[model samples]
Target: MWFSRGLGSLNGVITIDGLVKRRGKTEILSGVGFQALPGRVTGFLGPNGAGKSSTLRILLGLDRAQQGTALVNGVPFVSLADPVRTVGAVLDGSGAHRSRTGRAHLRWVARSAGLPLSRIDEVLELVGLADAGSKRVGRYSLGMGRRLALATALLGDPPVLVLDEPLNGLDPEGIRFIRTFLRERAESGRTVLLSSHLMGELAETVDDVVVIDRGRIVAQGTLAEVTGAHRSLEEAFFALVSR
Candidate 1:
């Protein structure tokens, strides 16, 4: 697939250790830690208000942690010589300007990152946005916007992908596409770390699971291991957070 091209020998290994974050008086993360290994889709699952976002922010170096470390490929995100080629992150909705066309938005990002403009078309096609590439961002539906955001992330062709609530705005078909795409990514030796509260979708997509609740990690293991004796991952998740 075009997405797997140029991946080369790079490895995507995300390691979070003893991360602690506080917002004034409230503790956001308490000794949170986990690993997202290459060749696997690791679902960072947690309910709303859980420390998932905070942990991801710290991992991407967008936010500071009071203590501990989050490393990508054994080095801090900021320390990477070519971050764009190492990690692709989609934290929010397409960070695109409403006035610009989808293609234009990607052109701007590509130029800024010193990447080839040709890559824009490839990503747009990969995300099923080739026809909408000329449309203004304001004209896009929520799912289209999410796809655009994913396209932007793929522009870097990074070895690792970190996505937050990626399935939120997608329809069933879109969800299925993403699930298959991420699985293919992992199968092709990339690391995928996604944070989401959609239990059913996650149960189908992830190879490994990491569950966090109330600022602490409650479970981390393979899909079967984390799910344990529960009827499903959703049940196990509820049981863990309810404790």
Candidate 2:
């Protein structure tokens, strides 16, 4: 995909084109193209092996694509001079040290970024972890861990947020909180790209969507444009991907 730096006045514009990835002889993605505009919660939807994780990894610069490009904020994520303030992500938080306190973990990240210590508590509270801020990560439930990961992502107050399965292990309340939070973030002129396999959730939470299947874009447009409310998102998704 090619972007001309003419993405209007959007604070962040993510462009991907011909994104190809191969693991050995098996092709993971082929010619995927899409654009995520700022100020909207763009849902990234796909089947179990539709290369969503691969795409997110490539976008975050954690993995390289064999072909094409993924640009964040009009530049490749890897080429960004300062990524912390440009983009924030929470792909997986299982890597965090289980024995460490949530506050300590956030403090470490802040220290690495040369950011002030107070920002840690602010983000922790922002993600609804204020009461459990001092608890060790191991003691926290999966929902709490997800909240902690969200806190980490919000630490930099980045303009773009890329989250994978953010509602993975959350309860109804947690999911509701995240839905509201993401909506508010977009209202604040930030960009949010959320990947999920849950079509029902996506239908309720997203303003726009990019649906992928077999590593290819099957549909891209506003929720109404992609899934006529008469046809549920799941119905539309299955019809598109199954083809």
TM-score of each: 0.94, 0.93
Error of 2 at 108 (Å): 1.6
> Which digits, one per residue and each the tens of the lDDT, describe model 2 over residues 18-62?
899999999999988888887899999998899998999999999
The numbered model that scores best in lDDT is 1
Tens-place lDDT per residue, model 1, 126-168, is: 9999999999999999999999999999998988999999998
Candidate 1 stretches with Cα past 4 Å from truth are: 1-10
Whole-model lDDT values for every prediction: 0.91, 0.86
- Could you tell me the lDDT of residue 101 within candidate 1? 99
Our tally of clashes for model 1 stands at: 0
